[model samples]
Target: MGSGFSVLLPVYDGDSPEFLERSFDSVTVDQTRPPSEVVIVQDGPVRPELTRMLARLVDRSDVPVVLVEIPVNGGLARALDLGLERCSHEIVARQDADDISVPERFAVQVPIVEGGADVVGSAIEEFVVEGDGGLVRVPPVGHEEIERYARFRSPFNHPSVVYRRSAVRAVGGYEELPLMEDYWLFARMIHAGAWAENVVEPLVLYRVGAGAYARRGGTRLLQSEVELQRRMWRAGMTSFWSFSRNVAVRGVYRVTPEPVRRRAYRAAVRRDAEREAHTDQHTDQPGTTDAGQD
Candidate 1:
């Protein structure tokens, strides 16, 4: 039998209502082949309502939910490290407190890990919720398409990823880099010769809300990529052409205006929608496996 998986959910205080409920529901696995354990690492103090909700979740748990509370606030990397240390399983999956994974996320990802890829992930579906209660779902992406973007930007959705515990440990786990810890982790993995693959399915429902990180322009994001490039070079993991291409890509993003960047994001979503429509038309005409998730 394959190794059972453990989930490390890192939650900071203040969570959106939709986000909290969706996150909890995503991991509220059914009786069959449930997670071996779930380590909820509370990063800091939470609102009374959040506390009450967590308490209720604990009481209602048919499977074990271990809550690891920190006395004070820790940053994202530290919180993840703490939860990772607590996991007893070989497969450690990541989830944010404010996002939801599709039901078959682990079911689909686990076999890919078992099949020998150190890092296995899937496409993500992002939902931007307006303050006035409206929500928009970004269109879907395929695994290969995501990989192409991964070289320049973060193609793999961090919270929607599952990785082999050994590989994570081998690379010194996650680092406390600014802004793009997830991207840095991927760079480290690729640098260390750790193979990665993604299911062509959309396995996560990611929540996007107004936050400081989002408000900040592309400066921080671009800086992180520069640091990633340095790290990759130090690790002797760079091809000359690929490195130059990455630099050129960052140069373009750096020069683009913020409004233009936002427009580009929206355009990417529209293109994804068109691609999906095309695929659907082709699939509907013949016997095809709808191997998609949302």
Candidate 2:
């Protein structure tokens, strides 16, 4: 049977009430199949205005909203762990306070998860504060491709995902990790025999700007990349060379000039867009089923 749906949202003081309201609306009002309940985890203290906003959002929403608070700032992974345990459904759809999930996302992904898929995610359209930007797409589509992609980059977009709680719990509940908690969890799941699929379609609008670029790179992210890749190496997920190479490339990308890094990222996105367009041109051509975690 198809598992029930619940949203897992982790918020912090940094998440604005404006974004939170939009996020809540996207899941509860915009969605074709709003989650049975929305489990929001307050990672730490929030502003008084945010507190008022949350209270009002819950008061007006039809779907139940369960809010949990961490006494202190524990970060995304820990907050997610809290939300996961409180989730009343077997299928948990992840959403970020700053992202807007497409209305049909749950409708499209539910069947895939019901058909034995453990994890499912889709591409995203990135937006600035005004909601206009490029598409942010994950590179892999199936389990085989996903694992290989993992040796390099995260195989799925974290916010555009729905995962089976049992499959995730079987591997291990969310554990705090440096910058890449989602990637780490997926790697462990793949290691534990769980399967995943990427829908190859954009299902969320991700918010980002210059600040995101700055946050994504630099010395701190370099350290996290190195630490994460090394963990994969220890787990036998990658060779020493792959580990070293990933660290070097990512570190360089991080420390590179922002303009150059931006161009490179944009170029890659352009290429992906072109390739997808070309594939779509051949309407009858056989291609990946966009099915099977493989």
Candidate 3:
């Protein structure tokens, strides 16, 4: 693959100007490799702020900004595929309108993309606003370990990923799976024996509820999990026993004692916070306006 790269940002109604501004801030660009293009796909009717943000970004950045507006909302996969087709570079990065990338995210990941991994993602930290001058922290985990633990849980947070345009296209880009498009893509990638690796660094600050996770109800989330199990089984990456174990663990989480469950959730969140802080030490400030390069 060549050194140049592009970013595909799929925007929707609720995306705010502040979020987009912050997203641009996190990418660390250098002269060696700068983002050649940023394709922002508006899947449906856009909010006033979102429109204003797009205008501002197109005007301010040196990189080319291509805005594609679709009359009807077809879903994320379709919007992403539309962006993918328009990309001109060899390396493509994914960003959600609401999720914020860490500074140096692309600068760090692009080199790995050349190392032959079809998909290169990283550990992630997440945050939820708390009352009165406070934010909650989420921790980072190892992807290899997470895959090993996937028999009982979903360990990879897909938003914090950067993949090769060719490898993803090889898997047919994004499929019409249940809800988690990233997970579905991962299943197919692993099944095809595509080389995918994860950097230990936490390169993205994924906003949970307001971003990707809130699009569905609880029933849909459960169904999506079940669907992933079936896909993995069919792909031969996971055995029936592993699928059953994952489902059983999720069921146990549902019926566990309140205090114990609360503690577990809190502990998990605290760990994420610690991991974010640690990764931040190696990264630049989160609010700078330098786009990433390949």
Candidate 4:
């Protein structure tokens, strides 16, 4: 197994320079096991502030930072596909420009990848501010549980994922799917028989605010949801009834009011107390499957 991994981060014009710096710091200076290199894709012409910030980050980084410039504004899928091509290592961990990874995130995930998992992800904590406590979104752990959960929802936290480049490329990297690109790629990987797992611990701090909730709803997202469901059905990842159910349920969720959507989203994640209770119930039990926690 290779000892080094690359960090793939794509930044666009709208991203805040401050957030980007923090993100870069988290994966580089702050990490216990820093990446061998960081491939930053400038999805388009960013603002002057972001441009300067990128220059400073590269200058300050101890590890190599590869900057790939896209002349025009392409979507996240395109940016990521292009970035993946530039990554120098077989193991590539994803990082979002606006999110912060825990210092030990890579330390905990890289070993699992070396141990034979094609893809590994972890729970994420969503926060409106930098220091405030946040709600944790925990996905199912273990390969079988991940495969079963993929039929209903995204099995991995895209920003928190560490995957093998060959596995992702063999399944044909990200395709254009608006808001559902990550889910689409993951679904394809899962269907292609990738070995996947998720850690119960939250490994990244996901930024969530009014904009995040607002983006979740809207006509465009509803349309994306419909198309995603159709693709999943055609791909044999979901049964006919499952596809229909997803369209009806997720489609409505997309078009609902932002406040209602926010409540629904929060309801799906666990609070600190709930997480502790769940850990107590599921951890260190004899002959018990990790699926019981989900």
Please give, for residues 182-240, the per-residue lDDT of candidate 3 as tens digits: 77777676566666666665677766554323343356666777777777877777888
lDDT of 1 by residue, 1-294 (tens): 667888888877777545665687687663234577888888889888888777777788766788889889878888888888888888888888887777778778878888887887776666665223222233234444444455656656687788988898899888987767888787677666777776556677666665522443477667766777666656665666777787777656655776776676667656755666676676677777542422
Clashing pairs in 4: none
The numbered model that scores best in TM-score is 4
State candidate 3's TM-score.
Answer: 0.77
How do all models score by TM-score?
Answer: 0.78, 0.92, 0.77, 0.95
Evaluate model 4: give its lDDT.
0.90
C-alpha displacement of 252 in model 4, angstroms?
A: 1.0
* Strongest candidate by lDDT: 4
In candidate 1 the C-alpha lDDT for residue 264 amounts to 65
What overall lDDT goes with each candidate model? 0.70, 0.83, 0.68, 0.90
Query: What does the lDDT read for residue 112 in candidate 3?
Result: 81
Ranking by lDDT: 4, 2, 1, 3
Better structure of 1 and 3 per TM-score: 1
Error of 1 at 114 (Å): 2.1
TM-score for candidate 4, residues paired by index: 0.95
**Steric overlap count per candidate:** 0, 0, 4, 0
* Of candidates 3 and 1, the better by lDDT: 1
